[model samples]
Target: MDIYQICPEFKKGQITLRQTETQDAEELLNCYSDEAAVPLFNSDNCHGDDFYYTTLERMKQAIDFWDFSYKNRYFVRWTIIINDTEEIIGTIEMFHRIAEDEFNHFGILRIDLQSRFEKQEIINDILEIVNENLYQAFEVNSILTKAIPLAGERIQSLLNNGYSPMNKRFMGYDDYYRRNRVDN
Candidate 1:
């Protein structure tokens, strides 16, 4: 799929995944500011951004950067919303990695969620949608994400969804996982 031409939306059960918008700044601020959630975010190779936006202005700035990234085809970021509450829970980012390392041409996925919603079930639900769609969206053979040992829920959800811990360091970073697409 040519994600640069059009971003797709995915919906199943109580979860909705759609391209992020400027108006999401206010609701997204809560997830970015959550002290407990900050540590769980995957900020690898982000040039030192920890994804902690404590204020509305900072959140807006981050959202602006996401927009710029999407426009430039640097990556695509989708906001995660819970249908029942209409609350913005987090975001999912995916990009086609271009590198000389073993991960070349792979899809890099980054999922950031509020600590309260970090349960294995909720994460499984979120990953279900992404796992079904992102491989084609990013046109990659496999997808990778980060999950530290401390992130038990995330690790379990990933394992349940066909992901396994990657033994090699990802561009000098550790605690990464990989899941290859199985051809039908």
Candidate 2:
């Protein structure tokens, strides 16, 4: 896969879209070890051997997915690597025909960051990345993103960046997951 050809939009002069996968997962793990990633990815609440195994499992899945190309087709999920470190900071995934057509475009399926780096500048940079990879350099009207109640600030940042929140409700988490799209 020509992963290097995907133009990267920079963040803090380092993170971009062109980084190599060789160092992606390991570096991401260091950042993923932060307090923020606990609730999001550590759903199994792992420790020691369990943590190591789980992390390895995750890395394996990532490599497999990245290497799995369908006849030169670009997969919907794009890994966002940090500038200086070149590790995956987050993922911007796009799923087509989401949940019976509740929304479209890229939905930020997952955003794991070092809780210490939760600043507006970083937030806006991510928005720029989203705009760069999204349809028409802007999030489509039909495309909407949803966050947990606790992610208010992050959601606000997106709105401030011109992403409008649609007034829609869902009945279940699984249903939302089934329909969730990514805004990469």
Candidate 3:
């Protein structure tokens, strides 16, 4: 399947994943500004302490970049909404990671959620959808996500969904996790 052909929205139980829009900048900025939610984000793209957007205007700029990236096929991202409250709770980003060297033909998944919504079940549910369909969408042989040491709940969810800590020597990055299609 062409990556762009993937649906703009997906529903799984209490959560709904929809294409993010410019209007979501406010809520999304709130999530990013949350003291508890900020640290859990992947530092690769987030750039650790350097990645901060303290205002709606800046967040809108970031959202614009996300939209531009999507248009260029750099990656696909969605705003996560809680069905019951109809609240925007988080965001999910996935991109094809195909390189000529190592880590070829893989999908890199990044999920950022509000601290309150960071539950094992919720994380599992979100990832299950990606695991089920991302291979086809990105034509990847495996999916990988980082679960930092402090992210115990996310680590557990990943384990429950068949992900294992990638070898330190092979990964060269400590504590990174992976779920290969063959493992499923």
Per-model C-alpha RMSD: 0.9, 6.6, 2.2
TM-score of 3: 0.90
Between prediction 1 and prediction 3, the one with superior lDDT is: 1
- Model 3 over residues 1-184: C-alpha lDDT tens digits? 5667654577887898888899998888868877787777775744343335688988888789888889888888899988888899879998887678578778888888888888997898898888787777778888888888899899999999889998663335456788888534
lDDT (tens digit, per residue) of candidate 1 on 128-166: 887888888788989999999899999999999999999
* lDDT of candidate model 2 versus the reference: 0.46
Clashes of each: 0, 10, 0
| Model 1 CA deviation exceeding 4 Å by range | none
C-alpha positional error of residue 4 in candidate 2 after TM-score superposition, expressed in Å: 13
Better of 1 and 3 by TM-score: 1
User: Which ten contiguous residues of candidate 1 have the minimum total lDDT?
Assistant: 121-130
Each model's lDDT comes to 0.91, 0.46, 0.81
Rank candidates, lDDT, best first.
1, 3, 2
lDDT of 2 at 67: 48
Sort the predicted structures by TM-score, highest score first: 1, 3, 2
